[model samples]
Target: MVFRVDMITLMFGLKRYHHLLILLGFIIATVMATEAMIIAAFPGIEEEFGVSSVIIAWILPAVMLVGAVLLLAIGSLGDILGKRRIVLACLIVYGAGVALAGYAPDMPTLLISRTLQGLGLAIAPLAYALVAEETPVEWVATSIGVLAATYGAGSFIGIMSGAFIIEQIGWRACFLVMVPVVLLLIVFAWHIIPDHGIRKKGKIDLIGMMLFAISILSGMIAITWIGLAGISDPLVWICIGVSICSLFLFLRHENQTEDPLLDLGMIHEAPFPEITINAFLVVFSFFILLQVMPYLIASPAGLALSVIYVGILLMPGSLTDMISGPLAGFMVSRKGVVIPFILGALFLLFGCGIYFLFPMTPVLVVCIWMIFSAGMSILLTIDNMIVVASAPPGSTATASAFLHTIQSIGGALGPIVAGAALTLYAPEEAFTVIFLVVLGVSAIILFQSAGIRRHLP
Candidate 1:
């Protein structure tokens, strides 16, 4: 009777969380759907504003910068206030930003509005925290896997359908249509997401937030300016200088503050550094696409595939990513972190290897990339679960945000590192060099598996 009762309680508790997982998935999917549409519509937006591609290119970086800036504060805020509060606020702001961008009269307005939507990135950290706080520990990985799967499925749908939406309905409609979806999410989140973790007495680390935001913003701007103004540009140097100083101050302040934005001591520990760095490398490695794919498929040093064919080629990757996400998460629950993470790294390396080993055809390129995408999903899912597991008491959201912020920094460096290869080598050579560098990064992640094994459950 006792054993039966325990089983019943466990099953009943987990069943509710299944609904929570679904809710979180839909929330993340909505955010991703909007994000992918913007990427697909970049050309149309550039043409609409009559701006040079160079000027309009800032749109993507602008969103990334805002996400990095807000993540620290949002994470901390969610911890002190409530995850539900923060999640709903992010949805509302993101929806407004998207809606405003649809009718933005000028380039500046559109840019600002688009950047505002980056607040939606807050939902990611909150999502992990919510599951960690609510779901059973043994089941957390499976739940995270579901989230990762949805992320893959969402991005694929968004990119695939987004391309069509941008073409038939116009770029404006892409942003405009998403407003209703966001509104629906806001409703779902309010009613469905349980509110718990509220620490009204906790202080907001305003100064720390400012310094961190400045550092991330300035540093990313430096990288962005390097592409725009050249390596020797004074603007780039100035931005770099500001970023360093802000970071020093931010670190110093955090060490002294009672309620710091990020508890450095908690994260500066073992496994966290190794895992977060690996996450960075994972993103930095994957941005090979940002550097190579467009040029490889459509440009002069190219397979010269049509747009439709390129889309078809990428279609399978989405499925692989969706599958790999849940698979990795499940592996972590069953097999522990080391094996799954190392496997992910191996998959990434193998993906890179195929490009060098085989002749580069459109079909081969697409098929090989699926392996890399799957690896990416696995590594990221494991990485997030680690953060979720390692979260400081009462600061789950803050910890998850910190990890993501690190990943975001890596994301910022990805394009710069990949683009540097292009400048130094011919297009084909550059692409090859970039993949080799990515392989090197993946190799390091695999190497760390041995050291990190003792740290995981």
Candidate 2:
């Protein structure tokens, strides 16, 4: 018998169990790729449906809302049942969603189909939880970094190729192609990902899940509308009201309940809150860059670069982002999370400061973006590791869901902040404002990290 070694494992320093890592990475990639591809395919979908952008815009928010709303429920459920079981179910739903989304003949059908895809969003959190449970403690950051690198690649491919696929083949192709890919992954995951019936003993916290769903859904609706509708919009106020009341109730319940969706006592412990808060800030800060860069390159006020040039210019950042993930993991393993956290924040701070102070030349912007991407990537990966490390023994998934939803709120705000800044000011001034805000956010990260380091042994 001949034995073959995976070069990928050798590169990552993961011994014999790299297959699990690869499978999880593929799952993350699929989710991220689908998101990017669908966004790219949106224009074609709009044309086909013969609907206004406003009418169709709900699709994106709807997808995100489902994920945010169900994350806690699903993650908690996964803890009670089993992560592998829940993940397999999610993959099935997502595959179906992708398949139907491709061939949907009407707006309603497409909406339903895509919403199904949103249901699968819990898989990413589950993936993290699985890694925490299965991998050695020392390798957690490195493993997650590899997955994050895959996310970067998936996003890059989806964005770059999605448009071309939309133009050459059709919008449906963008989605249809993933169906088989997902199906194959489902098979691999089902057979190989382990189902030793690992689960916690608890009842599903239905009330907590309901309140959390409403809270997240309402808040997201408000965030989605506030930029377009302004602060005074009645619907906006109504959603905000609901979100706040529900969130208040949800927290109160978590504190008192026997079968809580999230263990409030556990999460409230030191470093966890710190980790999540920094996650929110890093997500919020980097998201602004994601929203602004395309406009910066394409707008007459900025570079006015051609679409082709835009992809070429941005590719380096994504590539660097992909590379940085494992490297950051290595750093975390050697030096611990606080050092990487501080270094990452400094990278982000410097990136924001340089972009703010200097002119927007192509070379300069790319370099700044690379630095920013690296910084954000590191923080994002570390955030997951810390959450897993801090979570109660069997509740990694639930904790991850909490972190993701909070980060989602920050991610959601990225566009609103950019829109308000850019809409209210000249292009140059808007860019300045955006980076300045991120700089401030990064400063918070830096201060928090410094504080954390002071307390570390």
Candidate 3:
């Protein structure tokens, strides 16, 4: 009896970390569904609200802008409050947003609900931090990589399922779907996720938060307005000016503060900052296709693949992402960071070459794109591990959040840039241009990897 009890306890000790992972998967799935549903719901909402397609575009990016602006601060807050607690609060915020979105009676109300949904986006980096802190060192890389890949998985499932749901049920049903998922995640998270540690004690930086929020909001709005509404609009220029000034003030404040929302010193560290910048470039470069391709396929120029076909093409990317993520974790565990990062960069370059060679042919391009996505998956997964590993003991969430924020900002910018280029040039030409630019960035990443030897921490 004593032996059996001891064996049971030992087995549970090993399995305990998995509870956090389960929570992570659930959280990722819910947030992804929320994001996809908002996009899928847009056409329905636009029809009901009588808004233009251009106007509908605002619904998603606006939320992203809010997420990007708040991610670092929220992560820092998590560090100060406790990852599980902050995540619970975020879940409530997310659930409330979904409920509101479901019942929204007007365009303004729907927009507000969507904005609230964005609050939940911060959960992702927090999840990474939690896994990093809780999982054993042997499993850390693999677990974190898998957690990272869950986002892609969630995205795949959500978008594919969301379209079908929207068609069969109704637009409002899209938001309604989240209520159940969020409830489940909240319950699991409450039961499973361990308390990481106390957040640093301090008063929340309300002013800093305001300044940062204003800057990002203004900046994103300007970018979107310039692309959709025209750069000549007076409102665009006003936003631009406000964004620049607010950004300057925000940075200055960050520098002066004792308990700064983000310790910018992390940016100066080698490999962390460089790798994060690479993450931004990757998001800026590859994520553009995420937006453009779907539109193009649905339009006259593409193979006019149905949502199902598009989902199929996306499958390999997510699969490669899923496989590569753990592979990266394993590689990083045995071999150091440089080799994995270098291989990923080389793969990206090769993938870009493939894209440049075969842009027009949809079928062949999807295969090549998978190669590209595989490379990105390797890089992103490892890069996130690097971010968490590089941070000071307590600041993992903040560091991950900053890195994620950069990626989000890039995701926000990609569509606008790609869309504009497509508008001005031919699709083939636009693809070539995008690939060439990505190729250049990939080369830079390769060159930067050579310096990784200098910064192993």
Which candidate number would show the highest TM-score if scored against the true structure?
1
Candidate 3 accuracy as TM-score: 0.87
Relative to the unseen true structure, what is the C-alpha lDDT of residue 429 in candidate 2, on a scale of 0 to 100? 87
Q: Superposing all C-alpha atoms, what RMSD in Å does each candidate have to the true structure?
A: 4.3, 4.2, 3.9
- lDDT value, candidate 2, whole model: 0.76
How do the residues 1-457 of candidate 1 rate in per-residue lDDT, one tens digit apiece? 0112235347666466666678889988887777666555544565678864445555655566677777878888888878888899999999999899889887899889978888887789989888887788778888889898987787777767766766677667878888888998898777767777544456788998899888987876776666556869999899999999999999999999998887888888766888888888887777646445545665557686544444456667778988999999888877888888888888888888888788888877786779988989999999998887877678788889988887767765675555555655677887788778877877887777656777653
Q: Comparing candidate 2 with candidate 3, which one achieves the higher TM-score?
A: 3
lDDT of 2 at 419: 57
Q: Please, what is the TM-score per model?
A: 0.89, 0.86, 0.87
lDDT of 3 at 10: 76
lDDT of 2 by residue, 83-126 (tens): 77788999999899999988888999987887788866778788
What are the clash counts of all predictions, listed in order?
0, 0, 3
Q: Which runs in model 1 stand beyond 4 Å of their true positions?
A: 1-14, 43-57, 104-107, 198-200, 416-433, 454-457
